[model samples]
Target: MTYVFNPTYQLLVLASAFAAVHLLASGRTFIFASHTILFAALTAVLVSHGIEPYQTTAQAPGGLWVKLFYGAAKATWWIGGALMLVSSVRLFLIFEGRPREGRLVQDLLAGLIYTGAALSIVAYVFNVPVGTLIATSGVIAVILGLALQSTLSDVFSGVALNLGRPYSVGDWIILDTGVQGRVVETNWRATHLLNGTNDLVVIPNSTLAKSQLVNQSSPDETHGVTLTVRVITSRSPTQIQQVFSTILLGGRHTLREPAPLVTMGEMDGQSIGVELAFRVADAGQIITAKNEMLDLIFRHLKAEGLALATSVPNLGVPLNITSIGSAAADPSDQHDAIRDVPLFAALTENELNLLTQGVTRKTYARGTEIIHQGEKSGALMVVTRGVVIVEKELGNSRIELNRLSPGDFFGERGLLMGAEEPGFIRALSQVSVLEITSEDLSKILHARPDLADDLGATLAARLDAEAEYGVATPSMRRPLTIAHRIRHLFQL
Candidate 1:
């Protein structure tokens, strides 16, 4: 052990110690520059001690035995140095932005570099004939190639794939054999994939190179998703199209540029199939997107009184349901709907009657825009029947904010403070709404000044909640300073 401190061995021993410490500290054993320096230092120390490193025959400690030990040491040193140099170069290139080399290329290059260095060490350090080594290697190669035919095929195929650069890591690919996953790693033997179930799948590179693959992330992150549903043939095609379009447009991750397509498909028995096609954020989001679309479709259809024909035979007579939103809501029903709203809860019976009479009842069919984002609206819409989707248009895509059902109200800020609409409100079904305008609210406030405080508190609380969730509108911010704004808007 004291030999480690000798002048001839100090550099080699110190480098070895440093390399071991770096491996332990960093946990990065593949960083080969330190290993390369250690090996080169070992080679220099061994050469300085003796000329010949290996012996063909046995001898005393000072003669043949010493030569043989040094020869073996020299070979190991040179071979390790060559391997480390190759690895270091590959890692440097990778970090320097030449990612085309990848793992397969790095492994192949390392193997070839080490093999050549080993051959040179045999010929130069040990004085073996090159011709004999070549002849022997040729026979060994054939035997190894025959034994590892499948593995060799994978290696060559992996090289071809890396060079051709089809699908890279992080790409979502579906194989011809129905395997769909995101590419996590590509090596000489297999490519690793992370599937929807969070399981890792290892596929041979040879199989992937031969099979057809669809890379949903290649052209861009945008991916098209198609949903099919069967509807009763009794429903009008135009209304069905409108219903499906509204549902698609209201989807959270749905894109609006390509405009969703709703085409009538084949007829099946008593029902007709319709396709709702839309593009979402990416392949990874398709599952959640599909789930959202189905949920919306079920809710919207139920609200519109449309349903898929039952497989069970019905003895009852089929009622012919016609155009949606055609029936006008009765005044009494509108009055009842307004009375249910929490905002109008504080008003007296006479005040409520005045509001009910003053309110304008509007009907909108499916896909109708009841209110658009940024539009000036001084009226509060109370959903009397059916569903309305509140969404915000973000560039070319639309994200659903909330859904409104019967008894739910929106645009209170607009009615009280004269604020602009924060988002778009579209009818998802045959919808009826009772609208209470700013003028009607002002008339009530003039007669009853105490109601302004209740309204102001409610508005302030809603705005604060929206701001906390990062969805606060610019127009709604003014109402958050409740004292002055509410008094001024309501004329209190």
Candidate 2:
């Protein structure tokens, strides 16, 4: 007679209750990781007390009277233990910050656990010969493996990549094929990258493993930028290196710690080449820093009277000799510099001539401060040669506010409204500037009251930009308000 009630079945029910409790508490995995391990141990102990799951259903005593029920109990116990082992592995991975990365390893471990449990169920519950079943499975596994050889390669490659960790999420990497992007996610099959065009690129792990990769974000995020400039061999290379030094110094975006490197490269019959190497804060700053460096190169080249070599060879490099700026600019050249300024573009010829009458050309040695922060100046200064940096001092360090190239004007706030300068202007190299005093400005404005509108608007816009970039609190003062202030200040 088949027994309706069995003590062994009752024990299996109790074990199931414990497993339910563990599952219900699994939400607090971090806190319960240790508890899970202990619960796995307990399940293991209870499972061992039974006729080992390796036993066949026929081997279970008849006194239990229900062979089918005994087989199910054995399978349930082993299955429960397998589940607990998988949970323990998951819990450990969670503690190690998995699923973010190294996800494949966890899945592989869980799969192994399930495979073992399945094999045990077949052997103990169904009275199947373990050796025969394994042999059959081995053949099937071989057939499946051959069919999935490509997939297996990707799987193993992913495992290697995760373990090696050449790049992590958010790291910008450059591949051998020039596909560059920031790593967004990595999975068992492929890695996802957000490229510069903001498009998602999915690369299979096997292919990625085979290709050469460069991690730009490694060893800290500072990225090195190298730029090349070729110039006519009119000037000494040492002097050119000095000029390049000034160019690098004027780059507000380049890092100062590594020290900009200027190396003289190959010299042909026509021209010589120079390579400038520098570092920027990160990959994101590369474009901005490169643009700044190119602008500074042109400004310094013009200031030093050096000419960039023409691409058309054999035709001879025609240098733009408008003015050789190495020496102090004469009155005529100074007038041209001031006149070429966009701010004074609207002035009539006579009006521009009148504005230059009292303009004085001043030269400052490299590392000289043209104007201190909060200083009141009665003159408007325009950069005629070389570069100047507007810097805001904060505690021990200084922040670069802006860079002034040729024809760029400063000291306007102090000259126009008698207001203090917002930051200190320092000559990054031996720089030449044309200064127009308030006396000359007064005469010009008297002749043209309409000029106040342009000057005031320009001044307001500059202040607005400075406020946006620097630590200065932006004022609510509008350009119209500033134009009125200029009119009132100049008594126009």
Clash number by candidate, in order: 2, 0
TM-score for each model? 0.61, 0.73
> What is the C-alpha local distance difference test score of each model?
0.71, 0.77
For candidate 1, the lDDT comes to 0.71
TM-score between candidate 1 and the true structure? 0.61
Candidate 2 residue pairs in backbone clash: none
Candidate 2 residues 1-492, lDDT tens each?
A: 233323565556556665665566545364255445544554564455554554554565565546666676677767767766776676667423545675667788879999999988988788778789888789899999999999888889998998898988778999999998999988878999998789999999999999999999998899999999788777778887888887887787889898989999988765788999999988878889999888777666765667777465577755433333434544337666876577776778898889988989899998999899889988999887777998888779887778887768898888877788777899988888889998888888889888788887777677776776554344524677777877888788
- Could you tell me how far off, in angstroms, the CA of residue 57 lies in candidate 2 after the best superposition? 7.8
Instruction: Identify the candidate with maximal TM-score.
Output: 2
- Model 1 lDDT per residue over 1-492, tens place: 111213324544645554564456342344565666666666566556543333332222445645455455556566556756775756564622546437677777778887788777877666788779899789899999999999999989999998787888888999999998998988888999999999999999899999999999978888999988778775678877876766675566677778889998876556677899999877999999899888767645644556664443385655333322224433336665676566666678888877776788889998899889888677878876667887777789876667776556778767666676667989887788888877787777788777677777766665665564456755555543654677786657
Report residue 230 deviation for candidate 2 (angstroms): 1.8
